[model samples]
Structures are given as C-alpha cells and as structure tokens.
Target: MVSERAAQVLVASNRGPVTYAFREDGTLDARRGGGGLVSGLSAIGTDADALWVCAALGDGDREAVRRGVAEPGVRMLDIDATVHADAYNGIANSVLWFVHHMLYQTPLEPVFDAQFRRQWDAYRTYNRAFADALAAESAPGAVVMIQDYHLALAPGMLRELRPDLRIGHFSHTPWAPPEYFRMLPDDVAEELVRGMLGADRLGFLTWRWASAFMQCAGNVAEDGRIVSSAPDDPRPRIRHSPTGESAFRTTLVGVHGLGAEAGFLRRRSHELDVEERMVALRDQVGGEGDRKTIVRVDRTELSKNIVRGLLAFRTLLDERPEWRERVVHVAFAYPSRQDLPVYRDYTAEVARLSEEINAQYGTPGWTPVVLHVKDDFARSLAAYRIADVALVNPIRDGMNLVAKEIPVVSDAGCALVLSREAGAYEELGDEAIVVNPYDVTGTAAALHQALTMPDGERAERTKRLAAAATALPPQQWFLEQLHALEALGEGGEEADDLGRT
Candidate 1:
C-alpha cells in the first residue's frame, strides 16, 4: 500500500471536479468539471494544500480509481455500486430530496419500512466511507468542507474521528420546514440533525433555507440532545451535551446566496457556438424577429413544475387568441435523474404536453412551441440571449440560477415572470413579476403583462435584475463562507460574511 499526503484544506462532495469516461478500448477519458466550486477552489491558489474527496459514480470512475488515476489534489473512492445506488438514488434522491422539496404525495408515499431501514444502513456505510477518507487525508487542525444531503452524516462521523479539525457543511437545497421534517422517523430525524450539527459552521443558499435548518436542528425529536438559541437570533447554535464532561458544541450558521459569475457569462454568451445557436433559434421562433418569444430552460425535475408552466402557456393562448402566431414559447426541458421512475414519467409528460400545445395552436407558417429535450449549454445561452420574456416558476427551489442567468445574458431585455417560492425571489423579487407557482391563471396573466410591457421599462428592469443577481459572484460567495469558517478559529467575530450584502 502507498502512503498518502496530508492536506490542510479539503472539500468533500457526491461528485468531484473531474469525471472519467470508459473508452471502447481500455483507456479512460478524463474530463474536468466547471462551475462555482472549480472556480472558487482555483482562487485559493495551488499552494494551499487543498484536496477534494468524492465517490466513484460509475463503471468508468471505478476503473479510473482502480488504476489510481493521478489527477492532482483528487481522491476517488471506489465504493461498491450497490451501496452507491442505495445511498444516492434510494435515500439521498428519494427520501431527503422529497422531504426538502416537499414533493411527497403524503397519502400513498414515504412508508419507511424494513427495506428503508436496510437502505438507511447503506447510507450510513456510504457516509462512513467518505468520513474515513477525509479523516485519513486531513492534517491536524485542518478544515474539511462537506457538500449536500448525500453526505449529511459524514460530518458527525468525521468529528468523532478527528475532533480537532474545523468542519463546515453547505446545503444546496431548501431545507424542509419543521412540520414536514417531522414526517421522518423520530430517531432518523434526530440522527440527521445531530450529524449536521457536528459541523463547526453551516451554510445555505438563502436565509429562508438556513432558518429552516436552524428550526429543525433545534426541534429534532430526541431527549433534548440538540437545543438552539432563540429564533430571533441572527446566528444560532445547536447545543449538545448538557453535562460539562465533553462540554457543548455550538454550530454557527450563515447564508451565502450563490450568484452568477458575470464576467465569464458575458464572455461565453457571445462565443461562436452560442452565436450559431442563437441564429438557429431565432429562425425557429420567427425569421427577422417578427414574433415575441417566451423562454424557459430547466431540467425535468418534478420540483421545477414544468408541467404547470406548459399548462399556463396553453392557458395564455386560450385566453388571448390574438397572440397565437404572434409569439413562440421556447422550452428546453433537459433530462435529469432518468434512472428514477418518477423523473422518466415527468420527462414523458413534458414531451406530451408540448406536442399537445403544438397540435392545438400551431399553424403551417408558425410553431407555437419549440421543445428541445436534450441539454446543450450553447443552446441554453442562445435561448437566453433571444428571450423576450423568461418564465421561471418552480414549486420550490434552492436558487433557480436560470432566473438570474437570463437577465445577465439577454441581448434584448427580458422580463422575468418568477415564482415567489424560489430562493431567487428573495433577491430579485423587486424587479420580477412574481406569481404563485400553483396559480396557472395568475401566471398566464403575468405572462401577458410581461409580453406587453413597454420596451423601455423591460430594458430597465433587466438591468436592475442583472445587477442584483450578480451582487455576489461565485468566487466571492465561496470565499465569504471560507472566511466566516476561518474566522471561527481565529477567536474573531463569527459569521463575518453574514449581513455584508
């Protein structure tokens, strides 16, 4: 066995900054990941002694791990495929995702039985693997930052192994409110909260989500193992151990609403690929810009409420016949989590509804709706550039980046019809025409309002929306969290990043 090097800073997540693809031959094709995390980590500089720990997600990843694929500062654990499925699809996506997003039917679902218990055990084992890897790789007094629900339990597990390290956990989804959170088995709920409270600090995309987490952390059903400060407190803590033997652990909490990288987005939106796709999209919507375009880009996730969005577009045509061929709806419903039955059905339903609208409203010279199932970044950018009105109505979301991205990339100003429940609403609600996600009639009316707004007003609103949306760029958002976490150890003000916005 080869020895490993210790790192002063580490990041753990379900997926890493790179992925491997198995080739027809025996070789593996490695691809680097791009996004906020990649950009943020790069900002810390190469000499920071940073490392990323993630699980092998597929056969290709497993093969690369087996061969000890040497990509600097990354360690991929080749966990069992069965365990990965149970932890990822069964619990993380199925249970935690449903709870956080409030997607359960409630009448016929969420029956945690013997099989669920088995899966829960697998989830623990999966988390233990990550915790062990992190413990082995971390230096004394190091900082370990964990990401998302997939590894919720790892923080507590790692704390037990390395009590001296400073740990932080960031949740990328809206935390379920206390009432809905109690739907979980009592012990399981307590375990999850206790696990996360092990972190020195916790971060959320919005204050609403962070508040929900603090409520659950305080109210976990147990023998008062976890108790938080007053609800009015800006930053709260979870207290553990009543007796002073092991002392108490207080977890500092803060919100860091992730924002778009304005510079990269503006540059990339004008790339050759995006330019070509924009031309293609313009021709499809209507040659020579004769028609208005209502644009929506999202994954086929149930929480996105894509079906209701399509229904509202249909309602718009039915209510106002004059706009039939005068406008087009461009929808890009990208496939997500296709292995799950619910996601597959949702994707099919989106397709079916798009077809229904086209058949009902389309004419020889015009197509009312142009639906694309596959995901292409350039195409999404192209759609963003050409949007006259961007409809973003999700049932509940962490922060719908699409809502922010459109304003930043629109060549001609785009009016936003946003959902009140989205995390982004907290930031952009003033400039957006906000509506209830479930109110199709209200949404149709709002769409008409957006479509009819004076060009000058729309252009002005887009500027304000874009400005507010990019207030904290990705690098700043990330560094804020790191600074707040680091501040905790320096005997300085905690959560210094909070309220700076």
Candidate 2:
C-alpha cells in the first residue's frame, strides 16, 4: 500500500514557498514567500519529506525553470506566458474572484462570451500543468494537498491521473452561495464542483463556507443530491444517483480556521527594526502629546474596503468633534497587483479620500489621516505595536490574519473593529466591535466606541482574542489536514475519526 521511496507529502499552490529574483549581476536571489500557506508549510519543518509544486509567475521564475534550478524541496513549472496570463489575470482574478467575493455590479459586467471561453480553456490548461507536475512528482500512495481557488480543478484532474494518491483541496477564499455561484455558465459551474469533488477531503476556513459549497454542489450535480443525515451536524454527505453510490467514496468536508503564528509574532514584534519604526510612528501620530492612534494596515485591494474605511474615519470626525485633534488614523495602504487597472484605480481612490479628509480637517498640530503606500513589513509590525485600535474591514475574506495578529502583538491592548463580513468574524466576533462593511455611519460609531473603550475591558478582550486566534497554530493546522488526508487513505471511518479532532 505504500512505498518507502515515494515522497510522503506534496503541497501545490499558485505561488511556492520561495520565489526567485534576478539581481543586476544576473544571479538569482531566493527569498521566502509570505502567506498563511507558506507559514504553515514552514512550521512543518525542513525535516518533513515534502515537495512543494508551484507555477513560475515572473521572468525570473521562468529563467530559473529554464536553468532547471530547484529549491530545497520545490518544483517549478514553466507554462506558456500567454496561457498563464489569461488563466490568472483574466479568468482567476477578474472572473472567479469577482464571482466568489460577490463584488460584481451584476448589471454591467460579467459578460461571459467567446473571450471568456478562450480564457476558461487556458485556465484548464494551467490547472493541467499543475496536475501533471504533481502526478509526476508524487509517489505511490503519497498524500497531496492542493491550495486555494486557483487550483480548484486540480483535484479532479489529478484524481484521473493517479487514483492511488490521497488528494485533499483547501479553499482559502469564501465559497459563494448557490444563488451567486449560479452566475457561472451551467457547464462551468458543474465542472468546478466536480473538480473539487475529486478530493478525498475538502477543507474550508469556516463551516458557513463548507455548507455553501455543499449547497452549490447539490444545485449543480444532476445525478447527485447532498443529504445531511444529521441536521445539527456540520458535515454533509453527498449521495449520487438513484443507486446511492457516493462519489469518490465519501468526500470528508471540514472547517479549519487558519490563524497567525503567535510565537513568531510575539518574538518579531520586539525586534530592533520594529522598535525603531514604532518610535517614528509614535512621534508621527502623537506629535505634541499622547493621542489615540487608529491604525489600518492593508493592501490597496478593492475587497479590503480601504476607501470606505477612510470615509468612516471622516464620518467620525464630522459627527464627534472631540476626536478631531485627539485621534489620528495611520493607514498603511500597501500597493498590491499594480499591473491591474482596477487595483490601480482603487489605490488612487484611497489616496484621494485620505487627502480630502486631511484637507477638510487640517490643523498645524494634527492631520486627520497619514497614509503610506509601500510594502514594509517591519513598519506594519511597528504600527501593530503602537495601535490603539486595529481596523480590519474586508468585504469578504477567507480569514483576515491581521485581525488576529494585531491583538497578539499590540503593546497596550488594542480594540479591534472588524467587519462582520470577514471570515475572521466567525472566530473573533465575540470580542471585536463588529460593523457592517457597507455602513459608513455604523463603522464610524464603531471607531468611536473602540477609541473610547476602557483600558481594563480592552486588556481583557485582547487576552481572550489572542488565545482564540492562536488556539491552533500554523504547525498544528497543517498537520491536522495532513492527518485527515492520511486517515482517508486508511478508511472512511478512520477519516471521520480524525475529522472529529
């Protein structure tokens, strides 16, 4: 049933654990990638017998592929440039991402026609490249874990290639409900669900998303109907056709809320670089005296709701005159996906809003908003440390780790004002001042509440939030999924047993 020579585990995702950059001297510089997935894999330790397969995203990566360069435990696949662009920028980001996040205007957009079909074909080819690479690298009975919406089709594609391998697919984004998911063409919706059903175990960030997935599958599956034997049970079993034959021998669906590495954050928050930046930030926010600092650190992505966050801050100033000179909003709006026109426009809007607020309520001693548009991790950690309140209001997110990270690293307890729509709300809602992402006035009220929160109450809530955020660290998170996949290879009952953990 097993081969000693085969790799014990394989991780597949759009981006790898490490990325290569070309230096002026034409030499490759390897830098570790950043994300929850990378952090989880790193927690598994270098001793684990695992291979990570990822696509070459840039020219440096393509050149590295040409040179046949390999990282310690990584395999890079060089797909055609045009196909990769269409699949990633066109279909994945522009189409699928918009659909899942429910970000479309509905009436004017999502016009899927001949061009969409071409991009969809390229998307298929892109997934095929990854499936072929994973199939080639995997050993007999190896457990393969595919990550995120980018590779939604890989599980089914890989299953067709290697039935012996135990496959699991984890969705890092929130799954759209059946009604919204039906926006896809009939055939495309069915194919997407069937692709994911190829996995032995399907994992999501929350049970809500898992239920949504089951609903979508039920609506799309012509021959299959999903039935929950127990109403209260979070897990749903799908039974296909009149024969009652289950597809893929029972796909175990589960919820694993990804969290930040508290141990790492605790240690890194006090480093010299972070300390230096923290001092500068304190001086910037509290120029003359101690003023309350409301900090928001996010990429300038549309879903992050950065412009609305700025608007809420403006509303706070207009409604509550006392906070005009006593509070400062330090917004670190880092640039992300600059090549995309929509992202560029969003970034410009954030800048415009921040300037409008500052121009409207400017004093020599206090500026309403201090915005930074660059990538600086140390600076972000610095902001986290000095933050009196951390604002995280994504419209729809898988799990906003920043919501968890701020509470863990804040020097003085920070009040968290989180969006109800964020996936993090499932875990941190009890302690956070939750606001509707679309309500600017409500969010402004929330900000005022957070800023005026009592010190003792804030400290107590921070402790509880930190405990819940890091309950299952990255190491345990990855291992739990691995263990579930391994158990599936053993038997259905064994997988269910592991799932209970």
Best by TM-score: 1
Residue 237 C-alpha lDDT in model 1: 60
Each prediction's Cα lDDT score? 0.89, 0.85
Please list the residue runs of candidate 1 whose C-alpha ends up more than 4 Å from where it truly belongs after superposition.
Answer: 1-4, 242-246, 490-501
How does each model score on TM-score? 0.96, 0.94
Task: Supply the TM-score for candidate 1.
Answer: 0.96
Worst 10 residues of 1 by lDDT: 492-501
Give per-model CA RMSD: 3.3, 3.2
The residue ranges of model 2 lying beyond 4 angstroms of the native Cα positions read 1-6, 225-231, 240-248, 490-501
CA lDDT, candidate 2, residue 231: 19
Tell me the tens digit of each residue's lDDT in model 1 across 1-501: 112688988999999999999788879999998988888888789888999999999888998988988599999999889999999999999999999999999999999999899999999999999999999998877788899999999998988888778899999899999999999998898889878877888889988998898889777745555666665676666566532234556788778888888889999999999999998998899746889999999999999999999999999999999898998999999999999999999999999999999999999989999999988999999999999999999999999999999999999899999999999999999999999999999999999999999999999999999999999888888788777777666322244322221
Residue 342 displacement (Å), model 1: 0.7
lDDT of 2 by residue, 1-501 (tens): 233445778999988877789999998988887767777777668898888989999988998999987788888889999999999998889988888888999889889999999999999999999898888888877889999889999998988788888999999888999999999999899889878877888899987888888888778865534332231365555433222453334577888998889988999989999999988887878666579999999988778999889999999999999998899999999998788999999999999999999899979888879899988999999999888999999998878889999999998899999999889999999999999999999999999999999999999999999998998777788988988888765322233321220
